[model samples]
Target chain A: MKLRSQTRVILPYLGILAVYALLMAVGVPWLVRRGQLAAAETGAGFNPTSLVIYVVVISVVGLFAGLYVNLRADARQRHALNQLTQATRDLGEGRFKELEIPEDVGPLPETQALKGALESTAREIQYRMEAILKEQSMLSAVLSQMTDGLLIADDNGRVLLLNKMAEKLFMISQEKALGRSVVEVMRHHALVELWEKFRGGESKSITLEMGVNRNFLQVVGIRLDDEIPGRSMLLFQDLTQTHRLEIVRRDFISNISHELRTPMASLKALSETLLDGALEDPPAARRFVVRMDTEVDNLSQLVNELLELSRIESGRTNFDFQRVFPCGLMAKACERMTLQAERMGLSVGQECPDNLPQIFADPARISQVFINLIHNAIKFTPAGGKIQLSAWQDGGFVVFRVADTGVGIAQKDVSRIFERFYKADRARAGGGTGLGLSICKHMVEAHGGKIWAESEEGNGANFFFTIPVAST
Target chain B: MARLTLDRELRLVQDEILILGSLVEQAILNAVDALRRRDIAAAMEVQHNDRRINNKRFAIENRILILLATQSPMAHDLRLLAGMLEVITELERIGDYAKGIAKVCVRLAEEDTLIPIREITTMADKAISMLHRALDAFIAEDEAAARQIPLEDDEVDELYNLVYHKLIQTMINDPQAIDHANQILWVIHNLERTADRVTNICERIVFIHTGELMEMDSEDDESEDEDENLDTA
Candidate 1:
């Protein structure tokens, strides 16, 4: 340790001064008496007492001068030692930012070496800290940008680290979630249960549903690569939309089977009747053949509608855009459905306005939508029932309607009527293809329009659609 | 000297209790999820996993017993060891309730569901939330958080009452639905008991914090059967 005070620095020099003064007081007088004795023997004219006084005076002055020089030199060494001590203390506390030794105090060789060592030590510490920071930021950047949620849990199931995607997947903030148990933050039993099963290595992947939004997450728990005791990683991938699509695909298969089987059964029965001696009777054979042909036509139409609907839904079907008069389209649809309405003993009429704004749409597809609606109306309406086809401009689009005084749809089935192969109770009596309304909905939606039905059970039904008006 | 060793033992006991609590919570959640999905395999897995929860509780109990035997813990340390023993007991019972619910799931696997499954789910959710918060209070040694946990149990009770009446109404309307409704009622009862166990855990937390063993949960006045069961539990 450095001697800090000036008195401490000068105390040893003062002690040397005292010892020298005592020696001069005793030994110098003894030597002076001997010298005087020698001078008398030599008979020279010398003053012995004066010589003794002169020697004492010179020794006192020289001792005082040496003491002053010794004190200043010791103080400089103390100052140099103090600066080294301060720098060492700062380095001990890890305050590498300010490890400078004052230039004037540490001018000595030993202090200079000490300062050089401190500077290098501080530089090494700083380099290590910078390297650590860089690695941390790089790892965190990669984790945050990843689409999969990554969660690292300690042995006791506490959340040690979580990435941005993990925050969104678990619907918890990373700040509030750290050090909390997984069950506390996730709040999903499936994930907690998975962690338990995961402990035994029984299951790796588990599906968890989180929050009121019902987000489905497929969490895969993987053991950390270096066998870190009590630490594991969980990767979460959202699978809600995929699961929904799977359900839709399954439902469509069952619906298509039910739809195709009825027509197929009818065709089989008619063909069997003709083969079972109905061929011998001309009128019976002719009637059976015609019914079989109709069934075949219906089956083919169902297939055609299914293909068309799929094409439109998959965005493969393209539209030929044109400004078509709504009155002409309505008139043409009514004309096409006139025969079917007459056959069903229903009155079909057009109620289009003369100056209705033209619509930008695919004419062929629009005609297909209108034809399906009118055919459905003719199929369900009783004899003497009236079907009205109307068109008008509303808002940014021209709205079209096909209203029927028919056995209207039940309120419960109205929402699902536009789904593929969804046949209402009264519509099932008509035995037409079930994909008609679904195709119409897909076609209308493809044309940037919407279609919906307004009806009451045992009352009339009105199906309305809108197409964007042509910008003139 | 030996004081540091005793402190380390106390920490080990605390960690064991937390681990056991999490295991029991996981069991309950898995049991309820199995019930919702009607997955008999998942329900069976929950039942099988109850053994692990039991083993963990017993392991913690053994550690605490050894700690108490070898060392003389005074004041706060003594209270902590005693409180851990009591808290683990409550946790074990909660695990039993989860096992019971898993058993109900197995029985109701093939039956047509007549009652609203959403109500039962709501009851499970409330109970699980209470259990989670109670464990958090215990770990933090927060007396106020522990006191607030029992207040949340009232919501669980209300849900239980709602589930009870709805199940009873179903049994009254359709004679054929009686068997299924009875099984569902048992499931909801197990969830309610789990919520009750959570309150007991909170009470232990209060004891750990204040060194005062006071009943912090409110009485269920509406159900005489529930009150009787609570006393026995």
Candidate 2:
């Protein structure tokens, strides 16, 4: 190819030189003889020296012109080749800008055609490269933003891809986990078994619950036999919150059933006893009837308390918030419980400062909270023990306390006392429906306050609650 | 070519060890959970699953023996295979401990005494977590991590002590509860032993890295106390 191009450049110059040689060999000699003949005819001396010199000078000028033209043609070709080399270098370096081919390649058509082809090839590659990059970035963005964890592994169980959620779920870094075995990363036996099942064609997809205690994960594995042979994907969905809610719901159902059964059993036994023959004796019949009446009243109270608890829990119970003196609410609650406290040999006392800040709360609900606490205090306290009601302003709320000398709550059951139907060990024997503290919790929370208990078993119990101070 | 085959076979053995580790971990968790819920059926299931864990351990052991015979691994590889053998044994024993807890759960179901389930579950959590990290250190050949993991065993021991005293107090207060208290004590003893086994696994990890067989947590007196308690129970 190099020889052909070089020969093309020199061919025209060679043809010009050949024509000159032919003229010098044949035409020039003939012309010289004619000149000599003319000179002989004219009887003058025939001197051919000046004619030869003239022919040599013209041939030298023509040769210099051909050399100059060939040199200029070579320079243009070199310039075109340099441009093509630079474009190829830029393409290799990923700079896919337009190729700047000169308008002319010094009359070499093949060079011009090569330059055109290079330009079009760069454009095609640039277009395809941009499309691929766009798809890649989109895929990465989707993978990173996914809520569920995603992990893709090869047939050999080596991790090929993992998303941000997958990294978080396994507590592993992507760079470290990739190319590592899935079993090593997950560290769970069930997942390894799931992978084996997928490998053996036992199943296409499987879901299982993994993790211990409060943090539960539902893992879904799928074998990708068709899309990419011998690859698999895992999706991890965290089920901890759902599992906790299910537990709470189950506990509530069991507790509610246990609470209802005791009174129902008594009611059934009393009616059966009366039907068996207590009616023949009027006094005994009357006694059994009174017992049944008390049992019915207990059932009614339990039903009513359950309804009130549900209403408060669901935010269906409205609070008529009023600015009332804290002292007045304490006094009212003490007054309501004083008779019962005295009957049980416990003294009910109120210690609220008259100048304390008024609280924003439903007056009746706040009184009910106080009455419930005082009633609980009276029920648990021995004779001659004291039940004290105190209120003070703290921060933006009024803190109320009902302290009693009684068998206090156990350490473990302290946190759970506010759960409906949860009773302290002592409270179980000293009978009242176990919904009192749970109702108190909801009531105080509805007033935008907090409630808690501080106690030591066999010493005393102090129940505290807060209500927001009415803004002036 | 022989070197490549040995590397591949070693990886296969390591994978089997991990599978065995997970099975034992699951068993421990299920046993403690069954005790908490007083679910006799679940406890029986955990008991039944012990055979599977035993089979897995034997399978891994056979593979390691074959590797030792055929590959004749020297230096670090030999140490690794040997450490793996010890780890699987520890894992199998832990599985038996889980089965022991499950048996206690079954026995406790027949009695009316309330077991201190919260403390036992916490003990199980600590021990299983220690085992998990120990296995991770083994896989990564991390000597430093293996050294650090045994320190968590102290926490399990503390919980075990707390549960033991509480059960003793219960027995002293109510003589009728002595039988149930003994059963509960056995469960915690199993958990304490499981934690001890986790330390053993950690020791194996250190052995794999440094090629030295050394005890990590040498609380010989405490382990003796545990053994005495187990025998009395």
Best by lDDT: 2
Candidate 1 local lDDT, B58-167, one digit each (tens): 89889999988999888887888898898999888888888888888888887666445667778877887788778777877888988888888888889888889978
Cα-based lDDT at residue A403, candidate 2: 97
Which residue segments of model 1 deviate by more than 4 Å?
A1-101, A181-216, A225-230, A265-291, A334-356, A373-394, A400-434, A451-464, B1-233
Considering the true interface contacts (CA pairs under 8 Å between chains A and B), give the fraction that model 2 also has.
Answer: 0.62
Candidate 2 residues B3-70, lDDT tens each? 99999888878888888888898899999888888889989999999999999999989989998999
**Model 2's lDDT to the true fold?**
0.85
Q: Write candidate 1's Cα lDDT for A187-272 as tens digits.
A: 56457668777766554997766543457789998877468866888888988899888868987897788778888898888888
Q: How accurate is candidate 1 locally (lDDT)?
A: 0.80
Among all candidates shown, the one with the greatest DockQ: 2
- Supply DockQ values for each candidate: 0.10, 0.62
User: Distance from true position, residue A157, model 1, in Å?
Assistant: 4.2
TM-score, chain A only, candidate 1, equals 0.76
Q: Which ten residues in a row have the lowest lDDT in candidate 2 chain B?
A: B224-233
- The most accurate candidate by TM-score is 2
